[model samples]
Target: MALLILTMVRTGEGSINSLGAGGLITLEERDTLIAFQDFSFDTDGWDRAIQENSLPGLGPVLDGSVDTAVERVFALPEETALATIRFDMFLNGGWGREDTIHIILGEIQTLALGWPSDNSELVTFARDGLSVLAQSALLDPIRDNHRVARYSVELAVSFPADRLTLRLVPELVDGAQSNWAIDNVSVVARGPEA
Candidate 1:
């Protein structure tokens, strides 16, 4: 006789709404999820300098460039219940140990603690209303530079609203050269699983 093992998987049925070029979304169902992805500087919805860079096979990554400060506004559809949101953050030039990055959704803080004092790889926060899925450090060994590290965060939404505002505030200890960039922003709304 032979021993056998089995595993189980579950999948939920829901709708997904993604943000368009103008940061617009249309609602479908009560559990409809929305996500925003901006890879080009052609959109005027974003209020900042959008930079373009080419990769080997990944093509171009149009990023929301922010030297000192910048902000992006997003509006949600009605009859939608938000569940999670996420985005990718990049440190272009270089960042200092004292450099701080604040991720705010509406008026709630999504980052863990305050600013990083020592050089660390990644940081995750466990908090209510919102939670940090992942955060990268300012140092990179393969790039041989302190910059060029990509940080990403995912948050669980407890408060839902019609108009959702997401802002990335970076307090750089260094000069203007140390800039922060963001791209591939997404928001999802879902109902409680059955």
Candidate 2:
């Protein structure tokens, strides 16, 4: 019995056991690339106005302090083992404690952080956690010396995600006093099948 148990246990992680002709066959799982966003030409596969509010003189970006947010629904297989989301994010104008962003992923959270038991995944980045950039890239001559910064952020998540809803919402502190942006986003999943 011990020999049989050890034989079954050494098939490697994410390997499926299949009974073949008088033997066991193991199937391996691999990563599946799912590129969700390419903001170079236009914004596709993303929610319209709500997901993005373009600045009058800027390239494609999701802009708004809190009132506007970016949301994308990814339809993946029900057996996805791992997922990674990547994006280039930035915040323009002044920001404070209230400028933190919330990342809510349905099933990606491994442990509960006192949020709702419904898997309320939460993560943040603001203030000192990013690199401040020059506002000259903003192109608007409205004023000078406004707090501006950008960061390339990524998150590792898990899912049996049939319908995955990923949302990035900034806290609404002073009601649209400042704006933010996100671009070059992508999501990759790994599983037994596509």
Candidate 3:
């Protein structure tokens, strides 16, 4: 299936109040739970470890020690036709801006996203087998214990697979200072239509 993802570049401009209205979805009784991680307790087997006192109000977040990739794998339901993975991307410290960001899913589906130009809209292109629908919330200040950008991301899945992998790959500027993390992640899917 064609993987779709998008996001805004700046904070509070075209924002949706992360974890508030238009935020992440709450799991209902009817839905099948795939996975959820907020990093409030532990890393929960994620490649990155939980960094305490990373940001205020947001207790702990996954701090990437390895520069390779921050990834998580989930067992998907083959019976379902679609799935939605929602989470937030924290661009912390003093990092340089990029022209684009990529979110890889299941190792096959990928969504390439671009930053907003002069307008309020976040830029994206239909590259390869990807599409975008941008939505973003507030960003943090670039300081110690501050996050430069926090984007609430949602990936719409349209195909079935034995399992799905979600990956956030970042190329660091000053690896020692500039950092990244993901929080309040959850995956939910719908069954095939009759």
Candidate 4:
């Protein structure tokens, strides 16, 4: 498992603020270059509104205090390991263990692990201890059935690429409403795949 360093940054201001919020996770010695505020809908990069509403008891936003799930286009400086895109993600509301968040890399779709159907999944097996505790404590009673929690999953696929458009699709398998939030998304070069 590669080590990930999580850090948050903010740009612009208020709800209409562009770029909204973003995060960066360093992978040690790797050259990570990101243009701040590039994720704003106003810009040509990100496509969608940057959500700014407070997530009840979830405290401030995980990184930049701006929570949003929007599609964006990015180019890898070099060839990247499209097989696995890793990042920090959060899910809220009633979702089943089988329900997954779709990672669309260019045209490929990889179903990533998502929140469990029951709240007990957190207390029982402690799948994600910190995220579960944060979600359980900050979840609003009226908003959704359960609190919000964060998890990091490596989206497995075998596509190598120099540029890719990415989007996260939330599919509710159990006919329940759910929200997915993400931050610190990144793709690292894996050289030529033999």
Candidate 5:
């Protein structure tokens, strides 16, 4: 069997409205599912930096340049059973005085089949609307020399197979500054049969 490609959209230029319209596949039935691979963010200069040194009280600074970004890759069907999300990230760059990376899994939304309407909205991974699936922090005060800081996280969701959406946000911590980069961002789904 082959892997299903869900959505391959990029965020950062501005706010994106619908997941399916942004390249995400809409779910038709409860058993619908998809997966993602080679998710990336490459900037030309300092202009595309999402948030450099945006976090306070955190060590290291973030620099926003073409070399600074986030990358992640994941196989959903392999790590998850029934409905799971998995990803591996690589953060490369130099930390100045106070810069850090804030990796977040954005809200999840339920959409109709074919994504007929712009029913997509910012939602929570948890039903309580409080807890989130996964999040992480990257600090580089020592200037790891862009050594590919690696991270991975997995989540178990209760929503229907095809009606789920995932989002990621990377930001700088504190007012610090440094150059950051990312690569290999992916999201996949796994079921009992897989």
Candidate 6:
């Protein structure tokens, strides 16, 4: 039998706050990836308002205090293995109805034991419903009313591989916008496949 160990290789790291925009966050090295505030509405009438409130401003928003980025270490053959990802993310910004966040595993490109792959394959997990833990009531700026406050979500992802690309996406669910923060992303490599 082949013995495998799920170990963490990268954790508590983030990008240089220089790359943030579009609907993607790609990291060349083992760093924390931040999603730039880039969302749109169906109507142009709310363009200005949305841009001001939704754009994920530039800075070290996570700052290690909010999120920890972790990499996984697997003990398997060079080609076959499993990886598990866990994100202990927290929302520390002000409360608003329009705030939302998600941790996404894009795809696996290479099967090597290290990261920084040239090309990768994409795969998505199953998202059935809102995996929420807590909810509060907060003020809504756009609607000018009270909205459901923001909270945190502990997400886990299991896949078969060593190297892959992932991203964190946070958005404003309600018309009233607010900032969202993430912390502690733990990634581990599972044992060999059966």
Question: Model 3, range 1-194, lDDT digits (tens) per residue?
Answer: 01111112211243455333122355555467676666655666565555565655555666654365767777876686667677766656655445234678766546543333322334344444334444543454535645455666666666657577887666554444556666667778767666
The residue ranges of model 6 lying beyond 4 angstroms of the native Cα positions read: 1-80, 107-161, 173-177
What is the C-alpha lDDT profile of model 6 across 1-194, one tens digit per residue? 01011111121122112212112233333232221221222212111121223213221223211122322232322442333333323333443444444444444211111111122212223443212122122323323332222222222333344444445444444423244433223333434334
Residue 172, candidate 2: Cα error in Å is 2.8
**Model 3 lDDT, residue 156, Cα:** 62
Ranking by lDDT: 3, 1, 2, 4, 5, 6
Better of 4 and 5 by TM-score: 4
Q: What lDDT is reached at residue 120 by model 2?
A: 18
Model 4 scores worst on lDDT over the 10 consecutive residues at 128-137
Per model, state how many residue pairs clash. 1, 0, 0, 4, 31, 25
Q: Which candidate achieves the best TM-score against the true structure?
A: 3
lDDT of each: 0.51, 0.47, 0.56, 0.43, 0.34, 0.29
Clashing pairs in 2: none
- C-alpha-based local distance difference test score of model 6: 0.29
Model 1 C-alpha lDDT per residue in residues 1-194, reported as the tens digit of each score: 01000000000111011212112333445555554554543434556645565221222344544444455566666554456666556665555566666777778766632224444445656666555666554433323344355555566666567767776677766535565555555576765435
Over 4 Å off in model 3, which ranges? 1-30, 98-101, 112-131, 138-142, 145-147, 173-176
For candidate 4, write residues 1-194 as lDDT tens digits.
12121233241111111111224333434434432232221234556634433344322322221233456666665554432344545666665666666656667554444664444232211221111111112233535456665554444333345665667666667626656655445444344444
TM-score of candidate 2 versus the correct structure, residues matched by position: 0.56
Ranking by TM-score: 3, 1, 2, 4, 5, 6
Candidate 3 TM-score, true structure as reference: 0.70
